[model samples]
Target chain A: MSELSHRLSISIPFENDKQASMARKTMAVDPVLKSNELLIKFNQEENKLICQFMGTSDRVIRVAISNVIDNVKTIIECFDEFDGKDDVQFEEKQETI
Target chain B: MTQDLVPTAHYESPSEPKGYDFIPGDGPHSTIGETTKISDIVINAGGQDRDTPSEAKDTALGQLRARLTTIQDKINIFLTNKMKEEKSSKELKDLEKKMLDEGVDEGSSDNE
Candidate 1:
């Protein structure tokens, strides 16, 4: 069995208590999910992604989380490309049988 | 009576007063006036470190091109490696599925 590989992780903040609860719920199931108040950026020179979040207000935390997720997705997309070779693609025939 | 306009010649003359004599100061050293050196000094300083302008520019351009080529090579290597990893993972997954289908796991009588 091929192991799933994760290349990066990040976090952001949420200020809305209600939204923060919802976000926590989502993150509970997804290990890759995280949030921070400040938008994290991928620094090519540093060769790492960075994000910083501060403050306890729930509403702001939710916004931070959204921003963090968007930024992470953008960074991943920058490195990702369309290739027709993957575990799922290879196992398709076996699964049919 | 028609006024005759004489054509003026455009000539540049020295702006400073002509034939101005610069007399040395008649101080206490005037008796032993400063002597001017008539001989030229042959400077044996080191050679110029830099190339001619054209040569320098060519060298800079060549270096820039080399750096660009290196970056391109790195990008190509990264893309090739990514493709290889994808292919390798795919093949491994297929092999795993095949083993499961062939009852390779069931024949293990370790429990029996």
Candidate 2:
């Protein structure tokens, strides 16, 4: 009935500014599918990554937040597993079409 | 938007809890929108830094990992179980339609 007022904001911190920016860029790439029903924004503050969500109803907001957290975990895992190592080159070169 | 942005100086220290209003998903399927109808939950943590303070990287990592995992597990179970109600609703509609069609058939047979 009312406008989108249900809001949730999540802030995540990283070791440095670069990691925070990386998370923001990666997470912000995907736009909210139902903009009228829900809205999401990604921001980086120094070593922290921030996510804000507003939705028409609680249901929409919860689902959207869960999905975002899942993505965040994956990024955290990446940082945990391979934070500073150089990117590996495959033994054989593959041509890109 | 620039409207709600707060300066870094005003942000709280990492050691302190940002104290965001946590709304655990309501009902079995994380499917309740009732509570937030009138009031909003707002948590202002130094521009949203849930990360543990820098003194303990191990503690910070564990805290962050624990939080993400908890949210993931809880939501996954809720979203999975919430479909039961939806499925039952569809089945109920189908059963209603069948009963209506059968009633029409019974009436025709009575005429015959």
Candidate 3:
């Protein structure tokens, strides 16, 4: 294709570079289900995780971008739940899932 | 509020890709299981690509509404296709069964 039919960029600011990098790496590990119709690239800018989405259609990019946002929300939610909870019993036990 | 946990996004695009540095994948086909041939959510993109929001139709809300409409239209088309496929498949099966029954009846007459 001469030009991508749809494109979007999202920036999420984390607490630090480590957090941003973590988010980027985690999202990077997951594969894009539709590579032809959609491609996502994750980068880090200081404390911000920058995500770029290029796709062939509005719906394809929309679905993919929303999914990434949902996953990032979960990662941040985990930070809220246990990031600073030192000496928490949850960390001591092995994670099953 | 506990913190500013909002994510910002934009639609600005750069020059066309050079067909290089394209990350390789499992080819240019969908890797998702249970995929549908009905693709490309047909949508008339509004003033979402405008550099500045000049009117009500160019605002952030307007862009969101446009995007949502794309999804809505896609959902409608997908459901319609599903219904059409189901109806055609059912009719084909019924026709096959009818032909089989007619063949059996004709065979009985020849047996005499």
Q: TM-score winner among the candidates?
A: 2
**Which regions of candidate 2 are displaced past 4 Å?**
A93-97, B1-20, B23-63, B71-112
Whole-model alpha-carbon lDDT for candidate 2: 0.58
Write one digit per residue (lDDT tens) for candidate 3, span B1-112: 1333334565533332332121112222211212222233422433233222122133222232233233323333443454466578779999999999999999998998
Task: Estimate the lDDT of model 1.
Answer: 0.30
Candidate 2, residues B59-97: lDDT per residue as tens digits?
344345444444445444543343455467779999999
Against the native complex, each candidate's DockQ, computed on alpha carbons, is 0.01, 0.08, 0.15
- Cα-lDDT of candidate 3: 0.56
- The true-versus-predicted C-alpha distance at residue B84 of model 1, in Å, is 1.4
Estimate, for each residue in A3-52, the C-alpha lDDT of model 2 and write its tens digit.
77556676677767898899899998997898988888888879888888
lDDT of 2 at A50: 80
The predicted structure with the larger lDDT, 2 or 3, is: 2
Q: Best by lDDT, which number?
A: 2
Order the numbered candidates by DockQ, best leading: 3, 2, 1
For model 2, state the Cα shift of residue A53 in Å.
Answer: 0.4
Sequence-dependent TM-score of model 1? 0.23
Model with the higher lDDT, candidate 1 or 3: 3
